[model samples]
Target: MYDVSNPHYMGDHTGTRKFRRVLLKLSGEALREPGSTDNISPPIVEDIAAQIKAAHQTGLEIAVVVGGGNFWRGVSASNKGMERATADYMGMLATVMNSLALQSMLEAMDVPTRVQSAIEMKNVAEPFIRRVATRHLELGRVVIFAAGTGNPFFSTDTTAALRASEVGADCVFKATKVDGIYCSDPNKNPDAVRFDTISFHDCLTKQLKVMDATAFSLCMENNMPIIVFSMNEPDNIRRALVGESMGTLVNASGKDA
Candidate 1:
């Protein structure tokens, strides 16, 4: 009954993906429309949940780290003269809300989901415990990590890097507005080049922005791979999980550099 059609269901009967374990990083802005007033669109997230359900049925262990930009941006607020820590904590709370919303949507779709809060909001979600989260994955549960590293001055991008490592995920899939890594701002620079793959060393040395420096550094240091792809096109998430290669793959070896 979805207004938008779901991807062809892979179900429990499908072939294995190249990556058996993955961490998906979704931005808060992804849940909202570009010019609309709604902070979180029901149909959009429903479709996303449907995609995740299909992907999970493919037998991959999935973890999600969602940002709070749709609700609040701490750094942007801090630049406007508010106290930095207070602003960041507010941003964390916003992520909790987004996580609860996502958990509700996924569970509504009959996909077993858990919301693990880094801030310990026991009433709403389980506390973030690495072992417990890993066990949840082993049990075929979709784990949503919220509250961003349980500290101030950190970002959800950093949270994804840390959790992906802790959960022993094979890779991190960053679903965003842009389709892949570009040599320059695709919007501002019409002649910018899109890279199918890039090495972490080049991403750093050339100052290309796959993610925040801290997050990127962590992934590089740990030899973790990241796939950056667009979420605007339907089924991109499923394609990514299926390893169809629609995005830029950032790797540890500077082979592609």
Candidate 2:
């Protein structure tokens, strides 16, 4: 349905985006390089920004919810030797840093971007205001949401689902290290089976870890569809926005399955 070769192409054969509005879930760990401890890899982040710019140029309203695992994984920190709440707050700050980095790169690509934090850092980003964020999206500006629901225990996956519902997004695109949800860890099991599509009930029955339980439940309750795809492929973000079948789709109805 999409012209995969042209970055500026917005619509499909039907002359319109299959999904005009989508929420992109980005993990901070995805920004780091192999064997590198850097919180934000310049080349990686810039490439992601370029992809986002390409999709943005097509008139799609894009919103990103970034995680903080590259800087600090809250759960890991708590396991190592820190208090749970304190570690999670630190992780929230890490997300802020990643958001700023992404904003800078996106702006350099001439894509107007805004970083909104739930924790309300007036200096670095605007406070998370639902109306203002939606307006930014309506104006074709990329909005980066950070701080993971402004709470300690929640995750960025929940943020993506929450923001997608809040902004009336058609679907949530989960940019992941793997190509799609599998019966088992693809990295570990060579025989793992990848799912092109799966119902929410099936996902829960299998206990697939595409998203945390809370996040998945929220999307299921709201009847939101989620596409989990690999970010390793260049321009995959733009491709997904244009409705290419590049990942496994999760929904309440298993029609796509």
So what's the TM-score on candidate 1? 0.92
Residue 112 CA error for candidate 2 (Å)?
0.8
Give a tens-digit lDDT track for model 2, residues 6-43. Answer: 22324446533367788999998988998987777999
| lDDT assessment of candidate 2 | 0.86
TM-score per model over all chains: 0.92, 0.92
TM-score of 2: 0.92
Tens digit per residue, CA lDDT, model 1, 1-257: 10101122222323222667889999999888789989998888888888888989988889999999999999999999999999999999999988888899999989999999999877999999999999999999999999999899999999999999899888889998999999999989999999877877788887887698888899988778888999889899988876665678787653332
Evaluate residue 220 in candidate 2 and report its C-alpha lDDT on the 0 to 100 scale. Answer: 87
Q: lDDT of model 1 at residue 214?
A: 86
